[model samples]
Each structure stands twice: as structure tokens, then as C-alpha cells.
Target: MERTAPRPPPAVDPLRYRWVILGVATFTQAATAFFVQGIGAMGVHLQRDLDISTAQLGLLLSAAQFAPLLGFLVAGELLDRYNERWIVGTGATVVAAGLLLGSTAPGYASLLLVLLLVGAGYSTIQPGGTKSVASWFDPSRRGFAMGIRQAGLPLGAALSSAALPFLAGATSWRATLLAGGLVALLGAAVFMVFYRRPPHVTVPEDGPHLSLGAQLAARFGMVREPSMRKVLLSGLSLISVQCGVGILTVLYLYEKASLEAGAATLVLVASLGAGVAGRIVLAAWSDRVASRYTCVMTCMIAVIAGMAVLMTPLGREPVPASLTFVWLGFFGLGWYGPWLAYLTESAPPGKVGFALGMVMAVNQIAIVLVPPTLGLLKDLTGSYTPAWAVLTALTLATLAATAPAVAAVVSRQGLRRRPPYS
Candidate 1:
């Protein structure tokens, strides 16, 4: 009898449909982030109209960020248990309602409350989108898809940057805020209408499920692994990048660059636009590079950020002003797509959502912690140079840390192999 070759197991059809979910996911990010980030565009207006001090304005901006920190933890756990459409759609509605109410907010206290809602809004997008995207794209295409999705954030910021400043001029700040809020509601409806979670999976062999205490312990256990530890460090890098881009970039342009407020806003907005491209380019190309794309991102970020920090006469002239912001924008925003992809991929399949949440949680903690620390540094030193110096050190430290991470990943596989990308 002829020996029969073993039949190739029927290939499981991957979740190609999840890409549609990604499309909707993009809008949700754009919608929610627009309201929160629009503050930078309207800062001058808020200062003038509300008669708030710079520090007070910073607090309001920071407050929006603060509420979202807790969401990383809560949303992560909930995502693991619930239907994403309901969770995300509901969060979006709440976000919309909060901003609408804030549009007519009578006092600083009300504005703060509205901002709290904005943070809640931000919390939904990532936990929902990250897990959703992971289901559709394989590890190969992940960098691209995640990058594209992340690009929405910059797209949203750019839209707000371009539109809010002009809109603020055209009508009251309340109108601008209301307009953005309404757009977010539409985002909720779109997500509810189109986004679907991947079907529930049951492996032929069920692994032991993690209890709450067990899960936390497992999380710490995962963290202790050298590869996972790199993911966490990358996540911290993410936090610094977020602080630099989302909050500090525009401020750096306006005050330090001494550009007129409108021009400063425009330059920073241009960078946000570039981020949309950077995400697409860097992410898609990540799959083809010699090294795993994360390494490239790690290297690129260190070089660009270090140069930006040391570009000492940064805003002293127009050439440096334009170049620095563009360079800063590239480094600051470009890393999100890959680092997030890296974080998602590095995680075990069963625990991916929770892993992502942990990263986001750390990211939020950094968000809450970093801006204030940077602010205090700026306040005491009376210059951002010292602040930039500190960030520069951290950036370099991240670069040095990558070697061990790559080595650990290699040791696990044994012998030289192709990078994770094809």
C-alpha cells in the first residue's frame, strides 16, 4: 500500500471581516480625540473668554486626560467579558452627551465635569479597537492595520486643529465644542451600526482561565518575562510620546517658538497631518523591513527625539521652527502604530486584550504623571530646555534597552531567524 501523506488541516478562515470594524474604529478615535485635543487650538480663546490662568488652562487640559487613565484598567477587563459594539457605542454616546453639556457649561467646575466625560470617551476607543483589529489582521499585516487605525487619532487632531481655530473665530467656543460633540455622536452611531466583535472562540483544548487574583498575578508574571518587559518599556515610551505630542507639542510651538498663536497652531496641525501619513508609511513598511519593525521604530524614535531635544536653538528661527516641529511630529506620533502593534503581538493570544489594557493603564498613569512633572520642571526652571533634557535622557535609555529585548526574543526561537516581519 502506498503511504498516504497526511492531509493538510483545513485552514481556518481568518477574520477578514474585522477590517470593516477597523474602519469604524478609526472614526471613533477621530471623534473622541477631537474634543479632548481641540483644547490646544482653543487655549487662547479659553484664556481670554474664561479668564483662566495658564496653569488653570493646563489643569483643564490635564483633567480631560486624567479621567481616561482609569478607563484603561476598567475598559480592558470589560472588553474581555463584553460585546464591543455595546460597550464602545455606549461610551461614545456618553462622550457626546458630556461635550454637548459642556458646550454650555456655565463655570469652570462644569467644564471640568465635561472634561471628565471626554476622558471616559477616549477610554473606549483603544480597548475596543485594539482587540477588534487583532482578530482581523494576522501578525504579518498588524503593523499596517494598527498604524492606519492609530492614524485616525492624528487625523482627528488635525481636523480639530484646522477647524477649531477657524471655528472659534467664526462663532463662540460653545458652538465649536457642540459641533465636535455632535460629530462624536455620529461616530457612536456608525460604530454601533457597523462594528462587530469577532465570534467567541473556544479552543479544542481549553487553557486554565484566569481568576481576578490569578489574572493580576499572571499579568505580573507576564511582565516579569523579558520580552513582555520590553513591551512595558515601550509602553512607557508611548506615555512620554503622548505627553510630548498631545499636550506639549503645541505649547512648545506657541510659547517657546514664539510663533503667533494662529501660526503656531497651524504648524503643529501640519505635524498632525504628517502623523496620518507617518502611521500609514511606517506601519505598512514595517512588514518588509530587515529587522522587526519595532526595532526600527525604537531606533528612529531615539534618534529623532534626541535630535529634537538637542536642537537647542529650536525655535530661534523659522527654519528650525518648521524643521523641529516636523521632526518632532514624526518621532512623537510615528511610534504609536508600531509600538502598539508590538505590544499586541508580543502578548499571548488569550491574554491580548488584558495585555493591551495593562499597557494602556501604564500609559495613562504616565499621562497623568508626566505632564505635571514636565509642567513643574518648566515652572521651576523657567525654561523648557531642562525639561527637554530630561526627556532626551529617557529617549536614549529606551534605545539602549532595545538590544536586550531583541536578544531575549531571539533566544526563545533558537538560532538566527527572519525578523517577525516577512
Candidate 2:
């Protein structure tokens, strides 16, 4: 055989490589979150198989969120100290292990325990992925990039909602869990093998290293800034609405709107699909706007409008109700893109991880509390209307509280004559 020269590997463009980073980050997010996000979709199946009530089903979803309450703080510190590749990959691995173990659980209690384990793993993913994408992209394109990355959430939920329920119906809920684990494992493998820090960036070693305690204290101190307060407030309120939509959508449609179970789940899937689109569109819009916060506020206004519509008699009509929920899904879930972009841009230099963790940790309070509270409210009232009303009131309150601060921030930015990200 004639000797032939080997072909050199094709050169990867440094500028275009960030898209790869975005793809990996997004896939990792969706993969790791598959099972947890699908729990709501499995609610009807879980209640039947596990003999649990709606409140208990809500608890099941809440179980996975509980550990992240404290885990985000620790994960935040680790992200600041270490590389995101390992941080996010390990977290996804933990999620895989948790879900795989969960497939063997005999009852609701055991499943909750397993989900708690999953939550511990998931705590690292949100902030770590946010930091990774933010590091790869600059201010001008950052909002759109962050939006695309964040869209993985609804994308995951949408896929799971469509597939998991059918899997549960055909085989068992356990099979659905097993599938989620396998997907998450794949996500971990891909991210670990492929992800890299931006090559040109270097960590500054000039500053004196603060002890963990001092660093934590400094992170907590960020809460005092007016901008940070707005982030916290919006995160808390909007997350509650998001969780409400996830936990209650199918149930409300099936029970109150008198839709068939399958039809209700399809609506849930459609709503999540809308959310996926909303995140991308709103985020791209944020990049051109003077303030990313403005985009966030626009989402809140749209959600409020949707909630108001849901409170009326027309909300019971299948077409009108489904349309309203889809509308809510758009702004309610879409808000995170611009919101996270605003958060990343507002963080103190070299402390983006800490800021992400702090706000997410605070947001966890609502995540942990809202689902069960909404479930319980539905139980008490025998109506989903009150729950929707509560979400509307909460969002309105957040907007009212933050309006002055937003105005102040916008005024300052205008006076400085700088771009929003600057």
C-alpha cells in the first residue's frame, strides 16, 4: 500500500467556538433537568400509582427543590473557586445517580428522598451554566446567548411532558425515571468531555485570598445594593409564578377546565413550547433595549394580563383557557432570559458566581414554598382561581416595589451615557 499523508484536523474558529459552548451548556441544562422538570407531567400518574394526593404530588416536586435551598450557597462558592466543566458535569452525574436510584423507590416517601438527592446535584447547574455562558460571550450578545442557554429549561420540560407521561402510561412511572437518568448521564459525559474555559481569559491572582467565611460574607453583602435587591425581588416573585404554572397546569386544565387528561398534558406541552420560544425572542429583544430589566418587566406585565384573564368566567372555556395558559407560559417562563442576563451584567467583577448563587438561593425560598402552598390553596378552595389570583397579586407587588429602583437605575445609566450592559 502507498503511504499517504494524514489530513490535519480542521481549524476551529475562535470567534465561532462560543456557539459550541452555548450548545453544550444548553444541552447539559436540559439533560440534567429532565426528570425534575417532568415530575409535574407525571403528577397524574404518580397520584394513581403511589396513591398520593395533589398536595403530596406537589411535595414530590418540592422535594427535589428542598436541597437546592442550601446547596446553591455551597455550589456558588465552588464555582468561584473551580472550573465550571467539572462543577456542572459532576452535578449532572449526581442527578443521573439520583434518578437511577429513584427508579427503584417503592413509594412516594422513598421517591422524595431520592429527589432530594437530585436537588443537591442540581444546585450547581444553574449558576455554573450561567457563569460558563457569560464567560464565553461578551456584553453585546450576552443577553441572547443567555436566553438561548436558559431556554433549555422549558425545552427540557416540554420534551419530558410529551414523552414521560406516555412512557408512564405504557410501562410505568419508574420507566420514565430510568429514561431521564440515562439522558442525564449522557449530558454529563458530553459536557465533561467537551467544555472548556475561554482560552484568552485568565484568572487574576493578585488579590489576597479571602477565607471561605469572608467570601461568603461578601457575597451576602451584595444583597444591600439596590440593583441586587431588584434581582432578588423579581427572582422570588417570577419563580413562584413559574413553579405554579409547572405544578398546576395539567391539574387545572383536567379538573377545572374539564379537559381529558391527555388533552391537558398536551396543553402543558404546548405551554412549555411557548415558553421555549418566548425565552429566545425576549432575550434577543433585551440585547437591543436600553435595559435588560425592561424586558423582565414586560414579561411580568404580560403574565399579569394572562392571570387576569384566567380569573374570569371565560377561563373555563377550553380554547380561551388553553390560550391564556400558553400566554402565561410565554412571559412567565420567558422572563428568566432577560432576568439572568441582567443579573450577570449587574454582578461585581470576579463575583458573578456568588451573585448568581445568592439570588438563586433566595429564589429557592419561593421554589420550595410556592408549589405546596399553591397546591394547598387549591385543596382548600376547590378552585384554581385563587392560586392564579395569588400569583397575579405577588407579581404585581414585586413590580410595584421595584419600579422606583428600576427608574433610578435607568436614570443613572442615561446620565452615564453608557450601553445597558456597560
Candidate 3:
């Protein structure tokens, strides 16, 4: 027989595109989250420049979140129906424009209006990003991929938290806002240029759009799923803890630890930096253990421990306080990686967008409620002690909530050997 020439590999490997999706998705997430995450670092600046109370400052954070409350569901339906490239890219452009306009706002309410626009744009990014990356990877590797993508939030936060303090110090908060807007625009540009759906994924055909009644029915149907219900309940408590950590850390340090504003922001930077690493590490760990729930539970435990320290006399001492905050950052922000991965895994086939949007919308309820509530607590008591105690309590509550939720999910999965058929 004559020898045959060896066949060459395909011109483009589908596996390779998954990584491109991850890279662009991660960067877009970072850009979208940058200014919002820096709210804690910018706390002192906003307070002095706007002459706002802690409650008012918390409201600024909440303002950016308010529109997203409903926006996620709308974006979710859009993601399922449209190309993510356009949806995510256009949304980011909106973010840049809103932030640019926000920097020029003459008063607090105007700034809040600008941020509400930013939130409207941002509502698409999370579900869109999660849907983008989840489509690219399979179950085995999904946890790790989701971790890297989700880590973008804290990475952006850490970088901005570190730089924004100095940036605001150098010129003005308005200038800082302009720079952030520019960064978001860059992210939009980069994502538009680099991102494409995986080759195997089909683009939906243009057709009659979902009727309002149909869309509402579909959304309600997803919300009624048991796994989703559990995720919603679990995220409510945990997200409250996460949002509390982000909104309160800087103020807690400046007031409670008696640190200078600069020192406190630096501590906030440290917390977010640790969070970046924790997202990656715990996510990778989930890939290894084959259990996202384990990862979430572990984070809840660490958060409880970190919060306990914060309530102690030891947490009031500067060194211990710094370390405890870093610990909180690790678990506080880390929990989302596995949490999202679990959500992605549990979603009904072909409805990843709806699942992500719906779960996060539920999570937004806590995000909207927690920050200002904590700020109000601090304002009323004139101390962070009550606030920290409240956070500790929330974390403990999440611990109680997570265990049965995870068990229910696992039991439903039939992960354990099924009982002998009758």
C-alpha cells in the first residue's frame, strides 16, 4: 500500500475562541465595575465634596444599582434573543457616556441621575458576560473559567481603589470620574473588536420579538424553579454581606480604626486585592473538588470568622483591623465565583441568560437594600460596632441558608447513587 500524507488540523480550533471570549468578557466586566466598585475608596471624597451624609453616600452607590434591579431581567431576555457582542458592547458605551456626563453634574441629584443611566447600561454586562463565557466552556472546566471572568470585578475594583484615591487626591473627583469613563469606553472598544460567539453557537434569527406578556411569563417560569429559588435566598444574605463589605470597609477603617483617609483607602485596596486572588483560587479549587457549593460554604465560613474578628477588641487595633478586612475581602468577594458557576450549571439548557439575569436580579434586591441600611445603622449609632455586628449576623445567617440550599440542589441532581429502582 502507498503511504498517505498526514492530515492537517482545522484552520481554526473552536477551543481557542473560548479563551478569546473569556479575555474580552473579563476586561469588559472590569471596565463596567471599575467606578462603581471604587465607591468605597471614593467615600471620603464624595462626602466632603458633596457635603453628603453617610446615608446619602450609600444612596449614591444604591443609585447606580437601582436601575439594574429591573434592567437585569430586560437584559437577560435581550441576551437570549440577540448577539452578545452588540448587547454587551453597546451597553458599555452607554456606561462610558453616562459616566462622562456624570462627571459634569453640578449637584448630588444630578450625579445620581447620571449614575442611574450608567446602571441601565451595566445591567446587561453581568448576564451577558456570564452567558458568553458559559457558552464557551463545558461543565468540567466551567468553574475555573467563571472564576477568572468573575475575578475581573474585584481586579477592576482593586486597581481603581488603589489609583482613584491618589487620582482624586491629585486633581478632583470629577477628573477621576472622567478618567473612569474613558477606561469604560476603551473596554467597550476592545470588547467590540475582540469578542465573538463561539463557532458552535448559533446566532438567533431576527423575528417577531417576544410579546410583553410572553416575556413576563418566561421570566416568572424561571423564577419558580427550586434551584433558582434557593440561589435567590442564598444570594440575598450573602450579597448583603458582600455589598456591606464593599460599601462600609473604608468608612469603618477611617472612623473605627482611626486611620487617615489615605491609610484607610489603602486598606480597602488591600481587601480588594485579596479578593481578586480569592476569586481565582477558590474557583480553581471548585474545579478540582467538583463542588461549587463547597467553595461557597468555605467562603461563608471565612467571612463569619473575619466578621467575628472585626467585632472583637482585636479587630479595633490597627494591625489586626487591617488583616481582618483583608480576610473579609478574601471571602466576602470570593464567594461570587463559585456562586455564579453553580448558577450557570443549574440553569435550564439554553436559558443561561435568563438564569443569570434572574438570579442576579434577585441578588440586586440585597445590593439595593444593604449598603444604605448599613450606612444608616452607622449614622444612627455613631459607631461602626453595630454595623460590623450586623454584617457578622448576616454572614452567619448565610451560613445557615447555604447548607440546606446546597443539600437540596445536590439531592435534586442525583449526585449520590440513586436508590435501587423499585
Candidate 2: tens digits of C-alpha lDDT, residues 116-166: 999999999999999999998877788889889998888877788778989
Q: Which stretches of candidate 2 lie over 4 Å from their true place?
A: 1-12, 44-55, 105-109, 204-211, 254-261, 415-422
Clash counts for all predictions:
0, 0, 0
**Residue 16 in candidate 2 has what lDDT?**
87
- Please name the candidate that would achieve the greatest TM-score relative to the true structure: 2
TM-score for candidate 2: 0.89
lDDT of 3 by residue, 212-303 (tens): 78756765787677666657766776788888787787777887788897898788788888888888888777775535777888887888
| C-alpha RMSD by candidate, in order | 6.6, 4.3, 6.1
lDDT at 37, model 1: 69
Model 2, total clashes: 0
Better of 1 and 2 by lDDT: 2
Tens-digit lDDT string for candidate 1 (74-103): 776677667778778888888898889888
TM-scores for every candidate against the unseen true structure: 0.85, 0.89, 0.85
Clashing pairs in 3: none
Model 1, residue 396: C-alpha shift (Å): 1.7
Candidate 1 overall lDDT versus native = 0.72
